[model samples]
Target: MTEQPVPAPGMFTLVLHTHLPWLAHHGRWPVGEEWLYQSWAAAYLPLLRVLQTLAAEDRSHLVTLGMTPVVTAQLDDPYCLTGMHHWLANWELRGREAATRRSGADTGYTEPEALRAFGIREQAEARLALEDFEVSWRHGASPLLRGLIDTETIELLGGPLSHPFQPLLNPRLREFALREGLADAHARFAHTPRGIWAPECAYAPGMENGYAAAGVTHFMVDGPSLHGDTSLGRPVSGTDVIAFGRDLRVSYRVWSPKSGYPGHAAYRDFHTYDHVTGLKPARVTGRNVPSQDKAPYDPERADQAIDAHVADFVEVVRRRLVSESERIGRPAHVVAAFDTELFGHWWYEGPVWLERVLRALPEAGVPVGTLSDAIDGGFIGAPVDLPPSSWGSGKDWQVWSGDRVADLVALNTEVVDTALATVDKALAQAAVGSAWSPRDAVADQILRETLLTVSSDWPFMVSKDTAAEYARYRAHLHAHATREIADALAAGRREHAERLADGWNRADGLFGALDARRFPR
Candidate 1:
């Protein structure tokens, strides 16, 4: 038999950033912890299945997985673990109840039978999710992810605790956060990350120095952040720490946050839900069609669409890699990064599509690997001085510090000042300690609240008009917590500050290695 030559000479790296702001003890129903539980069940669990299957096949370096410390803290917290188990059990109950639910006669343009069918499907899905959670994630996410890292199935990327928008963060606090975040990863997985997802892929002109200081070898930014030439990872600010840009042309071909393959007419409609069963029954019939008039979702039809998309995406990557290699005079590199939650949480069929694409890419002569492989394989380019940018709108910092979230911007500034000053004062009054040693309780708690307040999610949510009210409330809540503790410490009310710290620790505490002295002198 004649041997077929390889189809392309390039590399494909898929990076999935898994993050959700710390939401363990927050609100439950409409948002907050609900988001955490849903994403865990829908996206994280299914995502683990996909990667786990590949791992079973002895696949190594399948993708790059970014796990933020803040999110990690929540996933491993005792409270969150208990809550997740309960949530999963309750989901099974809800599904069981819904399976026999009757649709209201006034159920706007949908048929009653479709709603019942969705309920039946949800019952089965919920049961499987619960079983998976029990068998795998019952302890925490650390063990599952640790196994992946140990087996080389995925390369882990660590980021700043709380996912603060580094460009907007104070340098001292930013440095402290990054160090603490890396330390957190080391504690959980026993591996120090050489790369980070860089919180929204946000970068500043001099931020590479921070990456260098924290021992980060590489991080990701948007394509435009690298001026649209993303064929290679470029060294930034003359530092050994490299910056890889997400290839948007190849990435957007799969999906973006608001659109892409997920918007196909044959796929499950994310926004259209059956209120009676708390299940999505509709397909994305048409862009102009109202939710009430949408057609029922069909798994078989979605699978067909997924197969078509998998083939198209593989072809697109093949062409891009060949053209880029020819243009750059080297075997070109492409990286497609997305939110891990986008898979099963936002797009119901996303996991299926992911598994399909990952398997198909290799068969199509595209070598799928992680970012670490790209760098080690010598995909380095010339140094580029990256401007202050993010993967957000305008490929700049607008989504975080723009006018829409101006109030949050101000709140963060004030909170940081108060927390930093209070910590400095506390340290001056007390005995000096090493960076790793835990300082005063009040100071540490204040820092914790301060870090949570500055998380990039708040401002991003506000700017995007997604859970805006909740974002505002959380920013103010964390800010207020910082001020309350800081004021108590300032007045020499040591007892009051300690008590406040104790009370707040029930909700805000995560990083046990967090020391107040590390923030300043």
Candidate 2:
């Protein structure tokens, strides 16, 4: 008898999560609308282009893309579109300024050739980004994303509105947020996502039931959440909802605490900036090197690094797939997850690396697919009980609920409790009286502010110490808005409540179609 052939290696899933706090009409410089526009120009636009190109070539379902409802709202907002256009135009102007200053004596450039090349490259990129924005992104990103989904080029994963740490949210609010978030995605894309990115990949026991009730078939979690056995997607306890654990061995190859491809000496340094033009001009010369001592960026050098890194990552995935499959005595699945913004925004060359990897994986006999496809392809594992966990530090809920952010946790509890109570009372009164409608604007705004206050960004920022003050201020501001509106509504001051709602609506307005009636009474 002929010897039986060994089965092929297991499949790979790349999960890229895209999210940002509601930034429209927020501050512009350093960390607000600027953050949104920068990421849009540098990351979202390029990634979309790559995926669309692949779709044109009949290569579909390249990766699983998660876009949160809050970020989607901002992307589709008219105000943000106009602002992004203006931001792009200004970027081109800055590029021109850099080019003109290249010949100046006080520019502090030891290499004139590199300076000139940087200027020309910056100008070209800015012009191209502007053109792309005008032609494709002028109306909104929803249509572009919808087309990709329609073509099956990606499996979209929707998440909660405002990206709250679900494990910490009140159960009623958690369900309300998840339902509303999915509804919002359907409204925009005409598709209901079966998978959720589960804000921060955070999970708690029993949350699977919530996901099941909300129609989510699968969600992602950290590898440790599965007892370090991330070779297969497992069902949560007895729930039918599946949880795919991120394979950190593969993911950390690209990014981790101690090392990552982004930290290579040839890659553009994210920290150092050219004060004159607000552009990054240096390469990461060394980990310990000061910004002033860093060498100028060389595109050729970065391209070589990208090629090497891409090859390295492909080999890593291939090895892991073969090893895990043999160990499990069956075909195993490897899921590598990442923050979408890390591509063009943080690492600059990340988009190029991604494009190459997507193409190279298939050539190496490693099948790449989305999490949904993995399950449909028969990679399910035994059920396991997941502990309270997140993709944050320590692989626990500490980043959002730790001692450093205890005040934020307390603030969120107080705000959510107050908002829910006020809204419930108003809904009851409306049912009893014929004059009031179920959809009260005051109550709606209150819930909106409450959701904003509970965003996991506040605590993450506080713990990480990056823009902590702004994060705290934003949380408190929304909480204050919720409280003031609730108080006005309680006092029978309809006019005052309307005024307060109108003001906060203009400032913190997102999810324009949200109706407070969706909340559980």
lDDT of each: 0.88, 0.90
lDDT of 1 by residue, 107-200 (tens): 4436667666766888898889888878888778899999999999999999999999998899999999999999999999999999999999
Model 2 regions lying over 4 Å from their true place: 1-8, 102-113, 433-438
lDDT tens digits by residue: candidate 2, 1-521: 86643334889999999999987776987889999999998899999999998999999879999999988888889989989999899988888777766453444444445665677789899999988888998679899999999999999999988999999999999998999999999999999999999999999999999999999999999999998999999999898899999999999999998899999999999987767777887899899998777899999999999999989998999899999999999989999999999999999999999999998888777788888899899999998899999999999999999899999999999989889989998887777847556577888888889999999998999999999999998999899999999999888998999999999999888877778877886
TM-score of 1: 0.96
Instruction: Specify the highest-lDDT model's number.
Output: 2
User: Superposing all C-alpha atoms, what RMSD in Å does each candidate have to the true structure?
Assistant: 1.9, 2.8
